[model samples]
Target: SHIIDVIECKTFEDLLATTQPLEEYLANAGCLRPLRRLEDKNLLVDDILMFQVLHRVRGPFERFRDGLRTLGVLDKIKGHPESFRPLLCWSPTMLTADLVDSLFTINLSPVGSNRRHAEEVGTQKLGTILAFATGANTVPPIGFFPQPSIEFLHQEQDTATPSKLPIANTCINCLKLPLHTSYRAFQENMDFALGNTHGFGMVKFLIVSHY
Candidate 1:
């Protein structure tokens, strides 16, 4: 099967640098010539790189968090890290309404779905993820669907330790705390979603297809 999409949550530049492996694979496999020839002839057959995140909840949030920490996301957030915007994130529960709307509108459909299944599932989360990751946002509102099937990690309170630099949210690529924003702001929101207990890495790529 052809590569439909690639959700490179490992920052845009990093992915570009890292795609050498994929490029090497294509070169070694002798597929690049045909693909490039087709491209030169205006015959597109693969995905257009779109920035987004896809999160899949498998066993538990803790498992996901640990996995992300291992993948260096936690470290990135702690320092002056560049962005590694993901196309989707899978969690056990749904996100807030505003965040959901920002990621995906309500009307978009799934990428591969039968009439019965589409009717039953509408725009399932996985379908939405695939659509956005593959640049399927042909209209004003992009993204597939929102599936809040799992439980959101409850917010935890941590002592206010003032910092000089801005704090970033790992899940949302561009989100950063304003310079003037106080640590209390973190307690109000960040501490809960992006605190020590619940890290952004907790919500990264996981092999899951929403139903």
Candidate 2:
């Protein structure tokens, strides 16, 4: 089920290009409120997704235009009151990186009970993937999630680390091993290593059979 949904969305465009809008997809996937919907909201979830996809994939100027087009407020303010016109006439040039950052960055830096709540809700996995895809990095609390202790694993294997998960914190479903490593050998090695540990919990063991 996880594989069918969140895991399949490898990129922002992958999500946006889907026939089902990402907001709807996420809403279906259990994030009831995908984006902060304010009372004065002019953009729908699809519009926001389109703007973000364009903003990231296109040039800055193109991104600005795309945002305006997606918002659809510009056209509606043709002959409105001066007060109403100012509300719609937002200059795309004034778009700050922080504003874009907020769009994708959920509560990544949660503390105490919030941190525990995130773990309970599987936010570590979901939030990590989303934040990484959208380039929103925030330090996670230490030992927030479990990780494998593989010596040969690359430090920069995934750009979304430093989430305070332990060493060798790769993707949620990945099990990293050296090239040409056999499945049996990897299994035997894990069995031996894990046998020594006291309480073994849920661990995904991935053995790459090919180099």
Candidate 3:
């Protein structure tokens, strides 16, 4: 039950100004003192701060975009293999299918998702995620997670226009839009394994193992 990493806020002043409830959560929880041991064992644990969670969810979108930001952040560190980042997100969730091809992103997909179960739009997205991750014609596994089955909301999520200052698109595919790079070609290659895979709150502390 050791957490592998955290993304700390930019500054104490900024965190305090934006997120008082989170400040209170950390202060009352005394999380750092109890987790010091786990922190010592995992090298990358020192790289991010656990407190960043507060600021990210302080306001609107009810932490939905914040959750996406967290997952996207996990995607960015796609090259780090020492540990994996487990996260909770609200909506418009993505699977790690595109990431596994990189030596780094493989660790991120402990459970895996697949568009094989989907039809139409969902299937297409999941397919894109899968093919991009595998780097081959071979279809990857797409099944339910053994424990904690996925619970997707029936309503389709509105694309919360990215927060101007905070959640700008980080997906390499997203960043390429300006260059007029053909994103459709990239889309055709991914596996959008849609399961209970992308959204889980309690899984955060389970991201890394002790031994």
lDDT of 3 by residue, 1-211 (tens): 1232132434445333433434455455343323322233233233224334553344655565566467576455555534443433244545575655453621222233443233244534544333222222244366322211222122227733311110111122121111113655323221112221242231122222211
Q: Which model, 1 or 3, shows the larger lDDT?
A: 1
What lDDT score goes with residue 30 in model 1? 40
- CA lDDT scores, all candidates in order: 0.37, 0.41, 0.33
lDDT of 1: 0.37
Candidate order by lDDT, decreasing, is 2, 1, 3
Better of 2 and 3 by lDDT: 2
For residues 74-104, could you state the per-residue lDDT of candidate 1 as single tens digits? 6775563344433233336567988787987
Q: Which structure is stronger by TM-score: 2 or 3?
A: 2
Task: Give per-residue lDDT, candidate 2, residue 196.
Answer: 32
The best candidate in terms of TM-score: 2
What TM-score does each of the candidates earn? Answer: 0.13, 0.16, 0.14
Q: Which pairs in model 2 have colliding backbones?
A: none
